[model samples]
Target chain A: MFPTPIQKRPVAAQALYQGLLPIALIMWLLPLIAVALFSIRPFSDFGAGNYWGWPSSFEMFHNYGQVFFNSDMPRYLWNSVLITVPTVVGAVALSCMTGFALGIYRFRGNLLIFFMFIAGNFVPFQILMVPVRDFTVSAGLYDTKLGLVLFHIAFQTGFCTLFMRNFIRALPYELIEAARVEGVSEWRIFWYVVLPLMRPATAALSVLIFTFIWNDYFWALVLTQGPNAQPVTAGITSFNSQFVAQYHLMSAGSIVAAIPPVAMFFLMQRHFIAGLTLGAVK
Target chain B: MSVTAPAVPHAPSERGWFQRNRMTLTPLLFLLPGVLFFAVYVVIPIFQSFQISLYEWDGLGEATYIGLGNYQELMTDRAFEVSIWNNVKWLVLYLLAIPAGLFIALFLNQTVVGIRLYKSLFFFPFVLSQVVVGLVFSWFYLPREGILNGVLAFFGLEPVNVLGDPTLATYGIIAAGLWPQTAYCMILYLTGLNAVDPEQIEAGRLDGAKGIRMLWYVVLPQLKPATFIAFVVTIIGALRSFDLISIMTNGGPFGSTRVLSFYMFEKALSEYGFRMGYGAAIAVVLFLIMLIFIGYFLWQMWQDEKEARR
Candidate 1:
């Protein structure tokens, strides 16, 4: 609206704008495009000094197979899914309840508690890192998917609760008041009346939590040590070390490590954008 | 009209003490699991780290209580100074995202064909993992054959070893970081620009305001919320910048690029004797630095909430 719409713009300016868009897009995505290109490039091409040239032969299929079959990539991916899925479900479900409580209740310390969750959400992870690792070890949950999942669920609850409470608070209170006046049980009122109405918030939160837990690198490093429990994010780091100068293989693994979250984003782009742009709009 | 319908009959027991008090208890019941987990994993650790900082341990055997020794050492440890300074540099450089994003937003705000696709394409960097960003940029900055060097060579200049030079390593990583952050800021500004008051723009135009004058006098003021969020997130991202530093240099070129987060990790986790206590002390310092921004942000949010309530 600010710049005149292209259809209404002068012809020369319009053509120039149209021409630059794709070029700009390519430059913007140059790194990812390079990675994709490098992943298919044969190892021979590297020593041959053909880094950016056309690939001598396409090894894309071989690279994918070797990454998935030979390396611990599949196992790492399973670890990611194992950690992320439960964190998403558990965090979202917990936040829904906690959000309802905080939003609807007229209790003392309500704002204080809400602000604590918000503040805790912003606290540096390093403060929690050492003691958390020690606690995980003592609990004998070290290097286990369960440990990562529990910690993620806890940490994510802070942000998810804040989002959910604000969302639920924005809903009409009359619905709950009507149910209460009819002597409906509080639990029933929440489940039968409120939850069904919270579908959009749930969807937004699920996609969000899924991506955050999946891409989490620091916690994965802290809790999991080996392929037995390491998620793809941390595994990629170790993989980089092993595949030093093996850019093709490393790039392929990076692609694999990125797929789940990328897939989630594309699949739920609307909700994902909605979740991220929450505070931006208002 | 729909409210005139007959009310559903209620069982007398529904008004009993249990039913009447259920509202008060149900919320607490709902809150328990999340609160318990949050307190155990997040809240308690802050205090635990504070306590751990008072001691000396390698995370095995017994921790020796050594009050202030780690802090004392940090006072003189050159690497600590280097990492802290790099973090400050990061914080300052990262602020470029706001203005960069706004300019890009202005450039791309036109309703051109495929503009939506363009926006998303520009936003792509934010989606990729920092590991991938670091890897790609490492290649991009790789001296002789790197893309940047190749471009420079085309212009008859010698290749610059951006990452190899201790002075430039932090800057190189900061540039990589800016690519994504600028994209994020662009998105926020795009959203803000969408909401800018058109009437105000027309009014300014009638008053002969144009270009930077119009933007500064009229448009930028309306973008306050977007700018605030961009500032806060960029600061947090800059302070937490560990992945890029780790993957790119590993605090290298003579330990010149260690940010606080990566430095703390090196102390705690690596086979570097697992100095958990010293690591905790470093973490506490980083946490306190972050708390400054967090406190200001919380105060701002409180003001916003109060205004909303009013």
Candidate 2:
């Protein structure tokens, strides 16, 4: 509106604006588009120097089939799901209680605790790397999916608590007061009153957390090893090494690794954006 | 009604201490699990890392008290200096995303046909993992078969190897990082723009402000929240740049692209020898730098909280 809507512009300017949109989008996504194009091409195309030309043969299924059936990609994908789902559930469940407490109750150390979560959420991962790995190793949870899941749930709680607490704060407080006056116990009040109202926040946090855990490379590298427990982000490197210089296959593999989160974003675009843009408007 | 009335009188007399004090107990009970987890994995480790940085250890043996020996060594390490300089560069240049995002947001702000689909498509890059972005850009910068070179050839200019050259490699990776970061900022601005007051825009028009003038004086002041968030995220993202450097260059072409995060990992974990003490020391430096921003952010939030309380 600030630029003056195109509807109010001259016909020539409107036409030009319409034409420019597609060009800008294409240019913006060109790098990703290149990878998509590369993924579907036959392996021979790279050898024949047909990189920019139309693919000599479409091997979309074959290349993707190799990733799914022939390699350890499926194993890695499964590891990612196994790791991500638990982390999402654990982080969300933990944050909901924390959010409820901080939002609903007046207590000593409330803001102090809240600020601790926020500050912890922003600290560099490096600072925690050595000690966390040390703790994990000592606990005999090293190189295990459970190890990754636990750490993720713990670390993600910081961000999730910040998000959930803020959201819960904005809820109507009278509902809880009414529930309390009805002689409902505190736990029941949370379960029956506050929990139901937090659905949108829960959905938003779940999708965001799912995508985050799935795309996590640093933790996966630190806590896990080999195809047995490594998530797809870390596993993609090994997948590439196994097929070094096979650009088509490597491209396909990386695409496959990227798809779960991409699909999650698309399906939950409303919630995802709602979660991400929570602070942008206000 | 009679049964409920009879039960009400008995309830308070039969109530235990837990029921009598549920108000105070409830929040603490609910807070226990999350607090425990956060303290163990996040809070305690921060202190532990500080402790580890002072001791010389190989991560497998007894650590000796060195008392800033690693920091002293860092003063003379060339790679550490390069990494610090690269970090400074990243912090400065990465801020370009904010303005670039605003530009894109303005360009796409209009309600043209199929605009919903266009907005999402424009935001596609941010959703992809940084590993994939790094891989995509690495190939895009390939000296021989890259589309960038192909474009240059089309324009009859010489093709340059972007990531292969030390001088350009860091910039190349930063550009790749910018692709997703810009998308993130654009989405934030788009959302912010949606909530802008129309009355103000119309008032600006009546006052002879148009285009850039309207944007600078009228629109931007309203977009402060979005800008603050953008600045916070961009600064944090710049400092936390590890995955791209790892995936694209691996601190490559003679370690030209290493930032503190990557260098810390290399020192602590990589095959370059597990100097856990040195790595922790590097992390401590990065942590101290981040603390400055963290302190400022918390102070701002504290002020906001006070205002809300008032």
Candidate 3:
């Protein structure tokens, strides 16, 4: 509105604006388009030095089939599901309680504890790297999905708590007060009143956390070494190293690795944006 | 609407003794699992990491307290120096995303057809995993056949080796990083722009404020929250830039692109050697750098909390 919408501008300028939009988008997505194009091509295309040229034949099914059928991609995908689902559930469940407590209560050390969670959320994952891995190893959870799930759940609780607290704070105080005045127990008030109202925030958080844990590579690399426990994010990179010169195959795997989060974003676009743009609007 | 008693000490239950102290205990009960998990994994580890930095250990044996030896070595370690410098460069250059994102947001803020799809497509990079991003860019920077080089060749120019040269490799990876970061910042700004006050903008317009002057005197001030969040995320992104470097260069061409996080991993976990103490020391430095920002973030939040209370 501030810039003056192009429709109000001269006819020529409006036409020019419309013309430039698609071109800009295409140029912006060139790398991705190239990857998609490459994903469908045969490895022979790479060998023939026809990298920029049209593929002689499209092998989309064969290439993608091999990625699924021949590789540990399925197991890695399974590991991602195994790790991410529990993390989303754990982080969301924990944050709901913490968020309810922090948002509703004004006791001493409340802000301090909230700030602790906020601070920990912002801290680099490196600080926890050596000790967490060592801790995981000592606990005999090393190279296991449970180790990754526990670590992610804890780390993600920081962000999710921040989100859930702000959301819970925004809810109507009277409803909660009404429940309390009815002589309902505190836990019951939270259970029946607050939890039912928090469905939207919980949904938003679960989708966001699911994407985060699914795309997490650094922790996957640190905790898990092999296909047995490694998620697709790390496994894709290792797959890159393992299958050198198989750019076609690697591109297929890249697309496969990217699917879940992409689907999550597309499916939960509004909630995803809501979670991310938490502080930007107000 | 506090669970705490407002006027009288209202006792709900007489059957269970827990009702007598429910006010003090209820919140704690709710906070227990989250607090316990966060304490063990995130909070206590800070102190443990600091302690680990003082000891010499390869993680399998006894950790002898060498007391600042790793930090001492860091002072002279050239890779450490390069990593720190590159991190500084990453921090500085990454700030470009703020202005770049604002520019894009301003361009696309208009009511256009398919604008939603356009915004989504522009934001597509952010949704992809960094590993995929790294792979895409590595291929994009391919010397002969990559699209960037292909474009250069089409223009009758020699293809530049982007990721191969040690000096340019860090910058190359940073460029790849910017593609998604700029998109992220743009989304933040677009959201901010949506909430801007039309009355204030009209007032500025009536005063003959236009273009850069209008943006500077009016819009930019209104955009402080978005800018603050953008700064926080970009700084953290720059520091946490391990995936790109690892995927693209792997600190290659004589180890030119090692940020502290990636360097910490190389020291502690890589086949290079398991210098856990040295890694912890590096992590401590990174942590300290982050503490400065974290302190400021907390201070800002604290001020807001005070304002809310008031």
Candidate 4:
């Protein structure tokens, strides 16, 4: 309502506002749009230096098929799935119990533990790079999907705990107090009472973590090596290196690597924003 | 699982010490798994990394403790100097995203038809990984075949190589980084706009305050939380700028674009040979730079916690 709505302005100004919306969007998304257009073009388009011109032929199916069938792209995509899903489940599940304890109970050292998670969540990833890699290597989990999954679960728990704790803290304390007075065991209280009410935070954190771990390149590069364990972000880079000058194919692979997170964003836009803007509006 | 209706002190005399101290023990039980993992993977490693910084070792060998040796070398290292300069540039320029995002959010904060779709389309860049953003931008800046050069050529000017220019490469990578970062800031601002108090705005309007003056005096204070969060994330993003540099320039054109994060990776992991201790030293420097912000954030959270307790 700030600055007044365009509808409240003159009719010509309203018309102008609507007309400029798409233009601004197109200009903002110019690079992504260009690649999206290139993804459907044939190899001849780039080889001939016909970069911005209309493609000589549409090769959408051919390019995407080449990415899917003629490469380790499928394997890398599978690796991404293997790494991300378990991290989401592990991080979310771990954070729930952690959040419940930190949020519901007032005990000695509670704030210290909660602050530890909050602080760890924001430190530079580089600080963890060498040690985490060494730790993973020593544990014999190096170059494996499980290595990446375990490291991600541990790293992501920091942020997830902060989110889940804040969410659980905001719930009415009376419900928890009433349940506690009935002498329900602590685990039963968490399982039946707190866990049921935590579904929204869980969904929000799950989608956010899925996108984050799916799109992760630093850890995928640091903790795992080769197509054996690398996620699509790193894999697609290697794929590009192999098929150099195949910008069309590269664009297609980029789109392929990007699809899952993009789809998740569209499908879960509200919850994703809720998770991201956890501290913004408040 | 039945709720205990008859509360006769739960027959406390019959319980063992474990059951008697359940209130104190239960929270720790719930916290054990998460705490163990966090302490092992996150907490312990921070100390380990700090310890490793004092020694000299290849990743696979015995560490020789030469206190302050690597830090002494860093005093005159030209690459370290450039990386630090570039980091400063990144930190300063990335702040542009906050103002730019606020501008865009104000532009799109309207009730036009199909506005939601427009907003999503604008936000689409943030969903893609920085690797993809880097690739798209590298191609976007290509001298002959890129859209940027194509546009210059269309204007009857010679094409300039952006990524290949030593002087411009750092700014070039920073621009690519700002693309997605701006989108992220815009989303935060949009959410902030939703929560701005309308009554204060009306009060300002009644007092003859309008537009920029009104925003400065009235609306800006309300957006403080959003601004604070946006600044924190932007600072962290600036310091953690590695993926795009890795994908786009690889610290190329004579290493003009190397930030601290990339330089640390190069020292620790790349084909440059794993000087693990030296890399740890660099990581330690980065960690110290980050500690300033981390300290501020923790202090703020502590104050908030105190307020909540009160």
Docking class of 2: high
CA lDDT, every prediction?
0.87, 0.94, 0.90, 0.90
Q: What are the per-residue Cα lDDT tens digits for candidate 3 across B1-310? A: 6577558755565467788777778998999999999999999998999999999999998999999999999999999999999999999999999999998888888898899999988886898888889999998898965889888888999889999999899999999999999999999999999998999999998999999998888888889999999999998898899999989999887999899999999999999999989999999999999899888988988887788776
In candidate 2 chain B, where is summed lDDT lowest over 10 consecutive residues? Answer: B1-10
DockQ: the better of candidates 1 and 2: 2
- Model 1, residue B112: distance off in Å is 2.3
Best by lDDT: 2
Q: lDDT of model 3 at residue A159?
A: 91
The candidate, 1 or 4, that scores higher on lDDT is 4
- Docking level of model 1: medium
Q: Residue A279's C-alpha lDDT in candidate 1? A: 78
**TM-score on alpha carbons, each prediction:** 0.95, 0.97, 0.97, 0.97
Q: Residue A61 in candidate 1 has what lDDT? A: 96
Per-candidate DockQ values are 0.59, 0.80, 0.80, 0.77
lDDT of 1 by residue, B162-265 (tens): 99999899999999999989998998898889998899988988998877888898988888888998998899999889888888898899999998999999
Give candidate 4's fnat, 2 decimals. 0.71
Once fitted onto the true fold, the runs of candidate 2 whose alpha carbons sit more than 4 angstroms away are B1-14
Q: What share of the true interface contacts does each candidate keep?
A: 0.57, 0.76, 0.75, 0.71
Candidate 4: regions farther than 4 A off: B1-11, B155-157
What's model 3's TM-score?
A: 0.97
